[model samples]
Target: MRIAQVCNVGEICGGTAACAWSITLAFPDVDHTVIFLSPPNSRTVEAFQHCQFHSAKSITDGMIRHLNVDLVILHNSTPNRVAQIRSTPSIQYHHSMGSRTAADVHLACSKWLHQRTPQSTQVLWQPTPIPIQRTDNPSRNAATSLRIGRICTPDDRKWPQSLIPLYERLAESFKNVEWEFIGAPGTLRESLQHACRGNARFITADVSARSRYWSWHALLYHHPTISESFGRTVAESMRCGTVPIVDRKGGFCEQIESGKNGFLCTNPDDFVAAIHQIQDRNHLSQLSQRAQDSSHEKCSLSIFRSRFLRILNQLSLGDSFDA
Candidate 1:
């Protein structure tokens, strides 16, 4: 079936754009078109040669109609903007906790989000493609310095305003650990550089590479100020078999079953203890395998395809959906 994935961001940077791109990749048999409300990034435009794209300042009913798509999926669109396409059969998708657009059939990306959303919304986990190469290091032993990574867009809003102290504490507690910060903001990186002198490595290059996700033995993530709606980074890390230690609030609580696949930290002390606990090579290996196994069950490509087809069937687009 022909589908139009409409998004507010033009670049494949944030979770909304990432999910749209992932959904496109998940359904290879379906014809997909991406509509970006903002002018798209040149690199992304060049890289995505397989799909048709539309870059516009605003989206309207006429614009969507012109695409001749069987379905229109709106990502993080404002309520007022969603009203413009009243005539179209569309799914208003919420990617953030802030999205409150009312629709007959809206979709939330996580169970946490679905619970908080209006009762009408359906939960649809974002599809994350598994890396073709397995990067799990089975030979890792107790002598190895556990590499813990933190990755996200270099935005202050995505970080805790006072995370320097936490980083310092983690650095002081484990001298042998390697702290890798991918896409850390400049000021944050400088502070971490100072506190974590030899123990830390701030990586500004190759932030989106799949290998980066798989390289980490564990992911240290905490955003007490801003809760993630679905925590795509945590999901991606899990897909790569990287155990994530994230804040116990927001969508993170849904992804991790503390002391199982991953750990959900409720406080700074909890974070430190969780990291220290994983120092055991045996425990780390078990959690990593469990995280990878759980990710396949939660967000794998096959699950996404089945859900997409189910949603299509519910929309009466089943006749057109060959898959």
Candidate 2:
């Protein structure tokens, strides 16, 4: 089946771009094409050599005539694209928590996101892919606390500032723990650097290599976010065997089981206390193991492919279109 995945493929920092990449990679058997609205840079354009890339001006005509894409997957926050592709058999994947007017099959990454959308909209829950090699680490240290920093575009909805206080408290309250910030170097990194002033425990580094970005040593610390359709980083952290301390928001409340796979905090105080309590090696080790297990069960490539293909089959069977 020919599938056209449409989104802003130029964006490398946000979850939307990451989700698009993952989806494309997961379903390699189906002929895939990525339609980018903006002019893609050399790096972005080169990344998806396996899939056909088309510019916005020629996307519609190509989709209708040349490609004849059987299924079109539209990433959220692209209403104009959705309107343009409304006539095609499409599935809208909601990567953000907001209202959308157009889409054939509306898939929400979290329950919170689904609740906010129109009830009539066809919704499905699918977590973002967490690509990591499943390895049995015999030397996995339980006592060592690794606090991985987050990388986010400057958006109030993501609550980027929430990490400052949480990290500060972690540094002050614990000694063995180390914090590292990874992502594109920007105002957020500068802000985090300034916040870590006089506090040498917190370290910041811009991500240079994509391969090392999601390493097992990087334990993700995501504080409360105002709007998140699904926390992709949470799954990525778990896939790498890095424990995540997420604020109870959006789908995080549903994804994380406190004291099992990861820690969930209600507020800044609760967040700080949770970090302090899990400072021991034993707890971190257990959390890491549980995280790896949980990721394998829910976010593994095989499971993702099965669920996605099932959805596609259902859509195809129900629709009048012939294969």
Error of 2 at 1 (Å): 1.8
Give the per-residue lDDT digits (tens) of candidate 1, residues 6-66: 8887667567877888888887877889988788776557635578998777777888788
Give the top-scoring candidate (lDDT).
Answer: 1
lDDT (C-alpha, whole model) for all candidates: 0.77, 0.61
> Roughly what TM-score does model 1 have, to 2 decimal places?
0.92
Residue 65 displacement (Å), model 1: 0.6
Q: Estimate each model's TM-score.
A: 0.92, 0.80
State the lDDT at 204 in candidate 2: 28
Stretches of candidate 1 off by over 4 Å are: 99-104, 132-143, 205-207
Which residue runs does candidate 2 get wrong by more than 4 Å? 57-63, 84-87, 99-101, 119-145, 153-163, 197-225, 317-323
